[model samples]
Target: MFEQAEAIAREMKISRSAVVAIALEEFIRRRIGIVPLGEKSNGKIVVASTDN
Candidate 1:
């Protein structure tokens, strides 16, 4: 798994640690149902349901 991650990091032109950090952050955020800010907008404040 580490070797594969290294390959991915090289291909993405980023450090392995950076790749791992991003992956871990994304995993934790997904597990906790966190949404990225500004992911959805129409130039207005709107209440949107994320339960898809």
Candidate 2:
């Protein structure tokens, strides 16, 4: 998923680590019943709420 991740990171001019961190956070947020906002793929952004 590095290729996909790098693509997004490069396109957004953000570090790959930052991108991954965002993804993980989104996943956790979703697990906690949060609705994130963004596209999700092998290495994409996901939408999950942030209401606890």
Candidate 3:
């Protein structure tokens, strides 16, 4: 995955760390259901509900 990250970093004109950070943030917000960018965190661990 490092190779992909490197390519994306070059394409985006950003550091590899920045690309990873952005990807992690999106993963947390979507897959993990963490709070969105603007809201406050409750200092509690959040787990997405499995029940559908």
Q: Model-by-model lDDT, in order?
A: 0.73, 0.80, 0.77
Least accurate stretch of 10 residues (summed lDDT) in model 1? 37-46
Q: Which scores higher on lDDT, 1 or 2? A: 2
Judging by TM-score against the true structure, name the best candidate.
2
Q: How many residue pairs clash in each candidate?
A: 0, 8, 0
TM-score of each: 0.61, 0.67, 0.59
Off by over 4 Å in 3: 32-52
lDDT of 1 by residue, 1-52 (tens): 9999999999999999998987886587668876533344456543454543
Which ten residues in a row are the worst by lDDT in model 3? 43-52
- Which candidate model has the greater lDDT, 1 or 3? 3
On lDDT, the candidate that comes out on top is 2
- Residues 1-52 of candidate 2: C-alpha lDDT, one tens digit per residue: 9999999999999999999998997799679765567756457676454544
Of candidates 3 and 2, the better by TM-score: 2
What TM-score does prediction 2 earn?
0.67
Model 2 local distance difference test score:
0.80
